[model samples]
Target: MPSSFCYKVLVCFLLTYSVQYMGFGRVELNAQEGYIFENPYQKTEKQTDVTSFTIYFNQKSSQIPKSDEVRLQSVADFLNQNRNYEIYIEAHAVDGKNYKEDILISEKRSLEVERFLLIHFVEEGQIRRLFYGNSKSPNRTKAHAALNRRVEIRLQQKN
Candidate 1:
């Protein structure tokens, strides 16, 4: 019985030692460095004052295309770093025959952007959405009309 108890104790010690040395679910300690845990999935915080990002939409479509999807990552990264910042999302739509339809489309676009940001862990209270519809467009050309269909994200630091 004593030999069996000694074996169990040795097994427990080995297990603890292996866990500590292999860095499995254990934090490493150092005199100068204090405590450190290596996590590959950890997101590195960025320091930046950049406060604006624009996401353009295709003609007559509220969905964000794959090409422009990457732009949201920068916004997410910025927001992640600046917890005290509030986001202002302004969505605009191109002028169509029906004014109300334009407004609805703009609102949908803004909501989509807001949803994306929220999914990236941004707080709901930090987001303010505004839809400009077709009223704010100054350009009459077809090429520029495409430019009007966009969602602009502006970040402001909380006081």
Candidate 2:
């Protein structure tokens, strides 16, 4: 009885904090799926995941794509409007080099994106960098390397 009660209390705490701190529009707890946080920033359309953006990079290149200029601008605008949210700049690269080289490449890309965000007036404190070169690739196959070489801008609520 005590163990079950403790678990219930813990689950409640998680649900509350997940919604409160993460700005989750809705939070659901289930034994099979665990905690699911719905997108809070979405206004008109319902999304399966959290509100975020992704920017892809060219092979061995860190320059922000011209086509993604609008997307980055939108991110900057959102951050400027919502001060309570911070962005996780997740960098990924294809596995074309040794482990260290892969990481370095990803780091360079992450830095470039950071600079872009900073120049756009997003608070320095609001940007966090996470570089995972090939290690976290969704697909490592040659054909999918292009998909791995990318940056994902994800939002997390300020604590």
Clashing pairs in 1: none
Whole-model Cα lDDT of every candidate shown, in order:
0.77, 0.81
**Model 2 C-alpha lDDT per residue in residues 111-133, reported as the tens digit of each score:** 99999989999999999999987
Q: Judge candidate 1 against the unseen true structure and give its global Cα lDDT, from 0 to 1.
A: 0.77
RMSD of each: 12.5, 18.2
Using Cα atoms with residue i matched to residue i, what is each candidate's TM-score against the true structure? 0.64, 0.66
Where model 2 places Cα greater than 4 Å from the true spot, the runs are 1-50
- The clash tally of candidate 1 reads 0
Q: Candidate 2, TM-score vs. the true structure?
A: 0.66
Winner by TM-score? 2
**Candidate with the greatest lDDT versus the true structure:** 2
